[model samples]
Target: MADHTIGTVADIPQGTRKIVVLEGIKIGVFNITGKFYAVKNTCPHQGAPLCEGSITGTILPSPPGEYVWGRDNEILRCPWHGWEFDITNGKSHYNPHQCFVKTYEVSIEEEEIDTVTVDTYPVNVEHGKVIVTV
Candidate 1:
């Protein structure tokens, strides 16, 4: 497995995202509730940068008669076509059968955060910035 140190936990604030380029791959790092997740920056539908998309809540169908507003869930929508994707799972809301982005394993050690990949690509966090090795 390729282990990479991405960045510090404080580099990415809650409800915010940052883009890191690694080995020609544009990665979007999001911080939600003090946790970190990394996924491909490009959207599946229109190849828009997911990092630049707006972060908003997901709408779900409520029970009949009684109206219930869905809670604020974080999602990234493509800027070009407005296709939404779950940041946690990298799944497209419009097309459940296909997934265009791949997520990497992220972990925190001391003050640094690391992003790991199946392949041997190095990634690490330093000085509040993520450095990816191709």
Candidate 2:
């Protein structure tokens, strides 16, 4: 367990992600909206490089024959097997409780002087970069 300053927030846009190798271990850092999340790059299923997969939302039926997509840029699908995992917590869409990807602790080193309002709450200044510790 160590802290590695992978990158800044601006490096990965709102709908994109960045991969950083720490101590020879690959980790995926994602920027959802403006928040940051980090997860182990290796997919629990078949040891695929999870960071190289596609990022999208989840589709569920709102009613009979009515499907709706939600959580845009919040889900990651493995390119190899199409396994869906939530970027927020690294949980597998299928068996989230039993089987899931490993999520790492992430924190942003923001410039404390500036703060921005998000909805009603205030978001700390991120200094245009993201930092991940794994």
Candidate 3:
């Protein structure tokens, strides 16, 4: 397992996603609001391109006759059959424990310029870029 620098933050704007292929496996890096999350591109159901589906909020459990919309832009819906999954953790809304897509840890390099002490030697700073551990 290793961390892959798929692309910069700019490649996936807020409320959007960028799909990257690592070791022939498709993964998606999503920007929800400002945070980034990575998940497998294939849906657990029907092998659909999960990342290519729509990113939107889902309906919440509410009192009868009342409607509540929650988790805005934090849900990923499979285009093939509208199966919803949480993008942050890749848990299926339908059956969280039994059915779900694979999730990866996502990180971003520190935005500010800072010195890195390597072998007691200071080195140049690193730019802020999106990374996924797979």
**Which candidate should be chosen as best, given lDDT against the real structure?**
3
Clashes of each: 9, 6, 0
Task: List CA RMSD, all candidates.
Answer: 15.9, 16.0, 13.5
lDDT of each: 0.76, 0.86, 0.89
Candidate 2 per-residue C-alpha lDDT over 67-114 given as tens digits, one digit per residue, 9 for 90 to 100: 899989889999899999999998999888987888888888874566
Candidate no. 3 TM-score = 0.80
Candidate 1's residue-wise lDDT over 8-115, tens digit each?
Answer: 677788888878888788988888778787889887666788768777767577777766544244677777778877777787777767764677777778853467
Q: For model 1, state the Cα shift of residue 98 in Å.
A: 2.5
lDDT of 3 by residue, 1-134 (tens): 98788777888889988999998999999999899999999988899999999989988999999999999999999999999999989999988999889998899985566788755443454476544433
After superposing candidate 3 on the true structure, give the runs of residues whose Cα lies further than 4 Å from its correct spot.
111-134
Find the 10 residues in a row with the least total lDDT in model 2. Answer: 117-126
- TM-score of every model? 0.72, 0.78, 0.80
Backbone clashes in model 3, listed as residue pairs:
none
Instruction: Show model 2 residue runs off by greater than 4 Å.
Output: 111-134
